[model samples]
Target: MRATLDFLLNEWLDVAALTRRPRFADHSSETFASVLDMSERLAATEFAPLNRLVDTQEPHFDGERVNLPRETHEALAKYAESGMLAATQDEDMGGMQLPFVVEMAASAFFYKASIGISSYAVLTTANANLLMVHGTERQKQVFAAPQLSGRWFGTMCLSEPQAGSSLSDIATRAVPDGGGFEDDALGPRYRLSGNKMWISGGDHEITENIVHLVLAKIPGPDGKLVPGTRGISLFIVPKMRVDAEGALTGERNDVTLAGLNHKLGNRGTTNCLLNFGEHGGAIGYRVGAPGEGLRCMFHMMNEARIRIGLGATALGMAGYEASVEYANTRSQGRRVGTSGKDAGAPPIAIVGHADVRRMLLAQKAYGEGALALALYSARLVDEQHTGDSAAAKDAERLLELLTPIAKSWPSEWCLEANSLAIQVHGGYGYTRDFAVEQHWRDNRLNMIHEGTHGVQALDLLGRKVPMEGGAALRLLLARIEDTVEKACTQEALREPATRLAAAVARLEQATQACAACSPPEAALSNAVPYLQGFGHVVLAWLWLDIAVRLDGRTDALARGKQFAMRYFFAHELPKVDAWFSVVASNDPTCLQVSADCF
Candidate 1:
């Protein structure tokens, strides 16, 4: 897998070219290699050994402090000591400032080893990143710095019990804490009273304190809360009171953990139901201008969505690797083409079976393709931040268009890969003896985490596809066409190239049809199907692109990539026809159905 990551980063992506850019001028291949080596070594030694432990021994409330296994603490300590927490931040902020793509590649190892433990760092980094972008200087120094250093952890408190994913329906309230609270150095201060649900890493003794970025609404002139997301605001609420220097004041904030959620997987990370201002209003400092909460919080949410996809990808990779190893060793019955009653013949490994190979190839196609997609998006982040002005703007639009796919596609398909891994394992996959079932369970949360499948689908078809007169989709199509043209010239990849080009043209037509339906809402009702088709088409393009790069090569990795790419183009790409048909016709079968018929 490290070799696979290297192939995608160096040979295919030409990440070395990034060194020529001024922001990455100080780095070279060696620096990136060293960072990846350290991450892999740490993950293999510290995190992998504890994955099952953390899953079996989940966090528990002991009536005083939440209790996690001692090994969990040690693993995190080793992680923080590795300095990966600040790998992508600035030197002045105590960061190494590695290229964002390299950082993402480095994280793949840790995520595969243990995503439950790795989640804390994901939220902490995203939190610090948002504050750096939108917080005042003092606020960054106070709240964001420690989290970056891993001295503290962070969580985004967006969903309330009643509101779930609807920010407009959130009932959390924040009131102005008069008496010069607005003049406080942290920012405009407020008294917040609300309950936030599904707050991952919301409470833990691993860090000295927890920083909760809460979204709440303030009362208007009529003393009534505003009715929509426009009235929402973001606040920094710490578990304990901290002074100007980020030191505890020996006094606690009003924030309290109501309970811990028992989850289906990734139980090592604490998911909390938190009651803010249980006794009175919790003291909070605003992050930006009033009523700009979601606008500001998108900084964290979008990044989280991408990372969540990576997490799901890594889990699928782990399962794929496990199943491959199992198939190579586990002796099974003779092949279907061979004699059915060869009593003297020796049983062959499952890998020798055709159906088993098909399953393994499917896993590789989905899992590795997803890895490529996530890394491609990561490079876009680097391009957005460090490329020339025109390139940066293009990168921005590409990233915006790809974010939902990056989030939802892997979350859905990778879970299918996990399921295939389980099937390859037979009955053992259903039991706790093997990790494939656990991998499926952990990856299952990703489709719903950060955002649900339907949420991302609507966002993709409704907003990202048609944005700016469809400039983003057009830009993406141009890139795909460039790849197709090049791949068509390669003898080994011509069919894949031709198939991918046709798929892209169909996708374009479907996008237009969906956008032009008689009633716009009816088309959007079929958004999830649109998402499935669009995702498969995107993967087809990526696979063909990679195969074109490796067409003439005969090495094991190259052959593997070629085979997987061919498998996807043959077995997976055709399904998009059905999905796109639903989108192109703006099918109202589901939308027009009567609810009572159920």
Candidate 2:
């Protein structure tokens, strides 16, 4: 249940060299542990109890308004009052200046408790972060302040009715306002007219204001629509207009709720179709330069990607917990090879069976592995921000390369772990009687949340893999090799070391094949397989790294780590073989299939 001890203390402390930095002079491991303790306590008390309630009683939307449970507002207020909303920001910005890794670790507790309710906080933090990075000084004071204090919520409006993932096809338009009405601090205002669909946390009464980070294109000098994302620009369109002092001017922006999008899971969070500038035009403040909305929004998109993975991991963790508790307490059939006497004997806990243990072990490998990857990615963010120039550059490149995997891998596989969690509970798991069912439903959205698996695969194989002439890929391999080398030194890890080394070799070959294959169409046909195989190799490396860390220990935790490594090596690692083969061969079967064949 507490893999954080091994990952945060043992893995990150050494890898990030936290103690050596003056920026962290006032902080220590104990400080970070206290955060975890507080988060665990708050999650157990506030969020965990409401997980099922929110799932069943979901937010209700009438034609005029959306209403959420009182408990949702209370829990979120407590979270904001706890100062976690600004945990990773600058002190001047009302943050504690904590390391990103610690912030992420603390967040996992709440995510595991209830992702549906946690959605509000996630969007607020990401919104504030984007504003800090790209917003003007006055923008932060006006928009980011209320969000950081949890008085206001935020949503990134990118997808439209017709443009699902294709930003280039977006039809939303923002025109410079020629009217005299304006604020002095929030910068130049524009009239934004568009409809944004699939906007989570888009419409809510829980906060005083909702900051909508809109993506719309500004027409060219010729007054014609720009063809693609190149014309897109980012805008800050609030539900209510605010003055320079961050007070509502009693005037509502033209942003209105078109309708609610009922979903299969995460029902506690309101997803809405937002109509911007319907009356005339919603007054919007530009966040960055024109034609840079996609580039600017990537700040939030990348953060959301990693957060999606962590949320998926947390859902898997929650499912695993429910399943394990059931397995330990529920009496089932006796051992398989029992006699007539044993047939009449008392049944044992289901966890005593081999198959159930396998299921639990698989969950452990995936859930914990995902946590490690998410935290590692968080550490990379910290490094990119504070490390020396060279280290920051390296971290930047590696972060880019790993971001797609960090987002997609857990989303795909951890959701699989949720399925196995259901399997561990058998028929009970399939029904609403068990929490695993909700967890499964909730986690399914993650694979399609930040980006679909297909989208991530294209990003990974088509873009990230070939960036900087493969320097980041080489760095990733070197890091894995370092782990493999250390693993080879121990007698217990030698076998895994060799096995993982072979996997790395195969992955290298697959990468080469991806780069060398001719024709963009042929080369990218099997990008999904490439992504899966690459993800497995990365997880294998992390598992081996954890195993090597436990080389001399003989405690139960060490044994668990060793067993998980064994399970990963024996069960999960080989999955890359078939996937890698498809990628290496540039298999065209799926691509070549005709629509009529179906």
Candidate 3:
């Protein structure tokens, strides 16, 4: 099923041809294509073969002992050996130093092969990035180096039983141990005591050591939990202590894997309940300044959010591909005109039916657009970090503004694509004999992983869009305008470009209307709607970009591109106008209702 879809999308879309473009002229696209090629090959040959085995034989813990599937371990080893583990690391650290765009492209393959295993690698990369950004020289040498080398694994411990999204509610504490600190030491180590929940890859036999970046509150000079996020500090707590010689000969830290969580999907990775300071106290060293835990964690969180979106997009792509293949091969009934004339003849493939084609096309439109959106956001991240000052600032602003949309929109919409995939498979999709059901289950988790859609919507409409005088939003609009102007020169893309321009204008007006509302809550009340509206506009712009690139071409692949772009503009872009109407009206029906009305 996947093979047929891959041939159609990868071949017909000319994704490989796009990769072969000149490196100097389109370095970002070239590098991204290379990474995609590597990942796709690895996923097809290595990870895909073990996905079902790992899923069936999930990691298990026997209170004091934990064991992972042999295939899972071997796959991790293969990934590390293949240099995938270091794709985003620095060249000096034995990494490819690929841009974020390339990393995202690489990640899509893993996501399609096995989301659970990909999550482990994603978390490890994000955790290493945090250490590289904030860790002291000694800390980076001891921890970050090993992690990037895949010698050690990493996890972020932020959630506790008492606290989920609200960090102020966190009860974990880090107390000063009063140990004498050497001049060359990183910091005076502290005693960590608390429990963390929903810690992915928290306990596994995949690596020798696990580095946990925990968020804990330390007593301030004034003492009372220190008010808010300022009281929280980030700590580097390892599973085992290491000596000055970099030997693991010291005592094991008092951290314990309390239990394993039973989840609906993503079972290949261990989601653990971790207890720190069980026996005495788990020794931890501070990563950054005191009262800066949330800030450091946000760095990891932001990156994870974007990666999560990418993962979701990939799953959607796989699901859509599966459905398209199934539709092309599975015979059910004849076409409407031939139903009576060919009653005794063999049924036609489901793809011949109008309704089935609708479903497949919808999936294509949603999933493909989502991939472009995520990749574009990743490219922006690369530009933000590696580009010159002016470009960097612009990329940073645009990324900040689009982060919520990238994370939330795909999380919600792509799950819908997965659902459509299941419907396309009929009874087979419901059984374990087919992988579509698993795709549905796996994709469902993404909607809640980084942040729920509601939470992201609040962050986008309430904070990101309007904060700092909406500079980010304004910058994003200017870039879309620039794209529109460039697209205008291409004769074939003029109409779609004009439609996209109108959508952008509508989005801007809605933004201004919401920004001008009397109370902030009024603006936030329709945030979800606003996000939907803005997402459509962004996707329209992406389609126009693709159309403009394919303009003046006569090849088969170019025609396919033209078809997809025109289909998107004709069928999907109009939805933005409907959303625009809702947002522009600033309806209060939803907000006016009382909680008890239900």
TM-score of each: 0.99, 0.97, 0.91
Best by lDDT: 1
lDDT of 1 by residue, 1-598 (tens): 8999999999888899999988788899999999999999999999999999999999999888899999888899889888898888888988998888899999999999999899988898899889999999999999989988889889999999998988899998999998888888778889999899999999989988888899999999998999989999999999999887778997889988899999999987999999998787999999899999999999999889889989999999999999999999999897665446466678989999889999999999999999999999999999999998999999999999899999999999999999999999999999999999989998999999788999999999999998999999999999999999998788777788888888888898899898789788998999998999999988888888888788679999999999999899889999999999988988889988998999
Worst 10 residues of 2 by lDDT: 7-16
The full ranking of all candidates by TM-score, starting with the best, is: 1, 2, 3
lDDT of 3 by residue, 391-429 (tens): 889888888888988888788778888888989999888
Clashing pairs in 2: 277-282
Q: What C-alpha lDDT values do all the predictions have?
A: 0.91, 0.88, 0.79
Report the number of clashing residue pairs per model. 0, 1, 0
lDDT of 2 by residue, 256-299 (tens): 88888888999889999989888999989998777888988999
Q: Candidate 3, overall lDDT?
A: 0.79
Better of 1 and 2 by lDDT: 1
Error of 3 at 221 (Å): 2.6
Task: Return the top candidate by TM-score.
Answer: 1
The predicted structure with the larger TM-score, 1 or 2, is 1
Ranking by lDDT: 1, 2, 3
- Which portions of model 3 show Cα errors greater than 4 Å? 1-35, 179-184, 338-341, 490-492
